[model samples]
Target chain A: MEYAYYPGCTLKQSAFPLDRQSRKVLRALGHGLTEIRDWNCCGATSASKLDDFLEVAMPARNIGIAESAGFEEMLIPCSACYSKTVVAKTRMNRDPRLKQEINSELAHQVRGEIRVSSILEPLFDAARSRELGQRVSRQLSGVVAACYYGCMLTRFPLDVDLRDDAENPGFMEAVLEAAGGTSLDWQEKTFCCGASATVYDRETALDLMGRIFSDALARGANCLVTLCPVCQMNMDAYQEAYCSRLGRSRRLPVLFITELVGLALGLGYKELYLDRHFVDPAPLLREMERQQETEAAS
Target chain B: MQEQTAFQVSGDAARELSAEIAGRSEQPIASCYQCRRCAAGCPVGEATGYLTPDRLIRMVLLGDRKMALNNDLVWRCLSCYTCGTRCPNGIHTSRVTETLKQMAREERLEPLHPKTDSFHRSFVKTSLFWGRMNEVGLMAAYQARVLWSCLKRRDFREMRSEISSQTRFGLSLFRLGRLHPGWTVSRGRRELGRLAAKSGRHSR
Candidate 1:
């Protein structure tokens, strides 16, 4: 499959690994990837608060670009971008008048036909087809992951074209399992990760992050895996502060699902940028390797 | 039935406020039936100083504009949409919060969470400025506004805290190569400027 990919703001810098490996892995799987020409920010949660038209128009602009570029599939790795764009398209499709008005202001016409999807869509498809498993060079035998959905992707199932159970999503689990990782069933799979609040409202962000981490830890999960940059960044970067605040020494690592898939697909730590995360996953991977060695000895 | 009243909506101004929010957010605020399912599922229910999803909806319904707009709930909403997914009435509290925040800003009311407001404003402004966000630009702009607000209030303690925390966290990010020194703008400036101006006019 060919895609016009939008890297958004974070993916270009802070979350570049997700962008880089998404390109490499998707290409390796025989998928064509093209970065959208001059795609702008989707306005995210901030846009909605700025102006209603902006919330729709900003993302609508990207959709229009993709549509005009004649791309059938537009893959956005960030959940915030994916959610806002999908919601904008859904609104435009539902309201013809709004569509026409937005179109008049749009530099490009939004035909509302280009299919937008999060990174999960392709990964899930490959996993389902066993194509991902076939290419898994290293089996993630001892890795246990908690697949996190982080609100935007699943919260508006009806409004957005997100195909999953918002309350109980398992696509990530299936995808990870194909890479030989074990996924645990946890209650906070669909919890909110306090997106931009991570910057402005540390109290709320930390509290939300703590709850998800506690739940995942309680379930005997080794790490929390998610596609949302906000989720990954906060949970991984803030775990130390949370641990210090709570006087708990145990740290929970948060990994981007793509990074784990990269590891399974024989990508190196530096290559996937795993070493940059605050809560290092190298120890966890080493522990997993030890467990596998013990089992082999037995 | 058991008591004098559990909740009630009366007064024209209050009802009008509810209607305005409903219309602006396009959410079915009228259908929110205090089911508390939203409260049951809200990730921030415990932390939001008694402003649960259902209670916020109740406040909106009752037209408590001050509380509705400047409350901890509005400032801290994650826009996670969990409440909307569970609302039998399909009322998205996230949308309601967004609308209330916008209204609060229009009223020129000082936001209870000045930092959040600063972050939001800087994020939007920088995104509009570059058509894509330059992380350095966003933080610099947001830091300036927040510091100015602190200075205006003469809250030196907060100013110190903000500076220390930002520097510590930001340095870590810079080391990890997340905080880039470079600025990258997109090629969609024409559309962004046109849309921003058009939206502002339409909003008015």
Candidate 2:
């Protein structure tokens, strides 16, 4: 299967691991991704707040670019980007005036038509059931993970509908099942990590993150897994900051869904971008390794 | 501004907003039992003081237009629908809040919160003009309102790196070269005028 992929801005920079692991997982699933030509930002947090028309046009430009690439569906991994693009498409499709205005403004830069979807949607669609069956190597027995959808993935459910149940979502449980891991029943999975506020308001962001982490840990989750890079970054990076600010020793490993999928696939640990994490996954890795060896000897 | 003390909404407007809400939501607002779940789950309310979903609903149910318009909670909502999903009674608190905001803005009873109107206006202007947000512009505007030092020192490097990377990915603020050529101040005025005209013609 071939797909048009829009990796977004974050995947290339600080959250490079998500991009690397996502591609690897898709490749292993026999899908090839052709990057959309001259794709632009989805105008999520800042853009949406700035100019409504620009928000639609910005993602529309990239969508048009992807459509021109001869791809019907565009796979986006970042939740923020996914929300923005899907929202833009929905708005443009609904508003003729908006469609004309944005198209007129971006007549030069844009090409083709794009139908945007989150990376999770296609993964859930194409490979989920089969990927579950292929899990013979290692089963993450007894490991409990909190599957975090964060806010972006579920926020605009009407537009994107990527989330299974907007009210009480647990689709991640099925994905986690493929890795032989049991996802915990946690309330904080759908909460916001204060995505863009990490820069402007560290205190509020930390308070929100701390609440999420504490709730998940209290429920006995070994780690938190999410699809959005911002969520992963905030959950991991802010753990240290929160620990320092509050005077405590705190460590909770944050894993992108692809990283967990990579682990289940028995791919090399470093290849999954495990090294880039601020909080080490070594303890969890060693424990999993030890468990695997014990099972082998037994 | 003496009229700004509060635009006392009548039973007619509250009933109208509630009826409009019911038409869209298919859920009754009067069923709300004052369970603070809506306020409890709100992400924006965690920061903005006293902007509770329950209180807004209370105002609507009681037809206390002045109370509803005066509260900052009416417009502070991010419309994430956390409250609606969490509400056992199926009350659409966000919709009620939105109608309140529209009514409040119309009656010139905008809450005297710091920079709230400016923030909303700037956000809408950015979206309407460029069809996306200009993050740099938003950051500059927000920072100007909150104070420069709140941004912290040495954060520019990080912000710059982020900006450059987004530009490479085609999410640049500079890309919004101009608003749609037809989107002039007069066009907006015309649209608003048309809306007011339509509403006026229909009201009779």
Candidate 3:
């Protein structure tokens, strides 16, 4: 299967491993990600603050580009992009006047026609069908991860029908488990990771991250498996800030669900950019793989 | 400034804010039953003093426009939609808070959290220009705005700390390839500019 892909700016610029690994993992599962031609930013939360029309217009414009490129739907991996575009698409669908106004202003076809989906949808389906299990070259037996959803994927009060439950989403774990990994049931799965609040107030963002780290660590989760680039970036980049606050050093590397899937498919650290994280995931994965080897030998 | 009088007095003025919020953001500020579910679930409840989702709505409902537009919640809202997820009525408080933030700006009230204002401005401006945000460009632009703000206020101490903290964070990001520096403008830049004009974008 091939879907029109929107890597978003973050995935291309900041969250590099997420985009690369997701594409590779999907390829291993016999799928393709075709980048949307000349896509703009989804405007994230920033545009929404400035003006309502700008908020919807930015994402709606990207959808228009995707639709014009002959795609019925586009796959966005970045949670922030996914949520912004999803909400805008939903609002545009319900408000004909607003849709027509934006369409005419931007010279888009203005019909809210194309569908939008997060990349997780297909991964979850592949896992459920046991295709993921069949394709897994290396079972992540000892890799225990707390499946984190952040906020964007959790609640869609609008008409965008998502696969997982709002409160306790299971798709991340299911995908990991299918790849022979252990999923730790955690309470802070849907907790906020402070989002763009990180830019203005690092303290608030880090504090929220601390709470998430505390919970996951207390639950014996070796690492956090997340789909949202913001959650992954916060937990990975600012981990030192988290540890220094506690007056002790501990590193709980946050891994993207896609990267984990790539690992299960026997992809290397270089391929996943595992060395690029602040809190290195290489040592942890090595240890887990050794454990798996030992269990198999015994 | 029909809405300005409501901020100063009470009665019909207070009621107008509620209606204005409804008309502007199209959020149902009136449907709040004060179940406190939103408050309990709010991720920033501990961080914010008295700006729980329910209380924020209450401020608008009571026509406390001054407080509503300039509160901690309005400036610091994560827009994570945790409140909306838990709300019985499905009222997304983030949208209400966003509407309040824009309201504060149009009134030219000094933002209570000036750094957040800087972030919003930098983010929108670059995103509008490049059609996407470059991590390095966004941060540099934000710091420049913040430092400029501090320079005007003659807050030398804040300028020093801001520089040091940002440098440290930037160094760390650079090491991780998180600060990958490149930009690609959308092909429809012309259309985007027209959209901004039609939407009344606050800045160029």
Per-candidate iRMSD: 2.1, 10.3, 1.7
Q: Which lDDT tens digits does candidate 1 get at residues A197-284?
A: 8788888788887888888888999888999988888888888877677677788778889888888889888988888888778888
CAPRI-wise, candidate 1 is: medium
Residues B1-204, candidate 2, lDDT per residue (tens digit)?
A: 122333356777778666755553345787888879888888877665554777667666656656765565654555556787778887756555555555555566635543444555554444334333344454445445444322454466655654554344233212322111222121222232232233331111
**Tens-digit per-residue lDDT, A95-196, candidate 3:** 999888888866546567778888888899999999999999889988989999998886763546777898889988989999989989888999998887
Tens digits of per-residue lDDT for model 3 on B1-204?
012322344888678999999778777879999999989988888878666889888878888877888878788788877788778887888889888888889899998998998898899888887777888788889999999999999999999999998898888888777777666567766677788888874653
Error of 3 at B166 (Å): 1.7
Q: Which stretches of candidate 1 lie over 4 Å from their true place?
A: A291-298, B1-10, B201-204
Can you give the DockQ of every candidate in the order shown? 0.62, 0.09, 0.67
RMSD of each: 2.9, 8.9, 2.9
TM-score of chain B of each: 0.89, 0.54, 0.90
Clashing pairs in 1: none
The B-chain TM-score of model 2 reads 0.54
Q: Candidate 2: which stretches are off by over 4 Å?
A: A108-115, A135-142, A157-163, A243-248, B1-37, B44-49, B54-79, B84-204
What digit string (tens of lDDT, one per residue) describes model 1 on residues B1-204? 011224445688678989999898888888877989888888777777467878888887887666777877887777788888888888888888988989988888978887888888888888888989888788889999989988999999999999999899889998887776777888787788887887773222
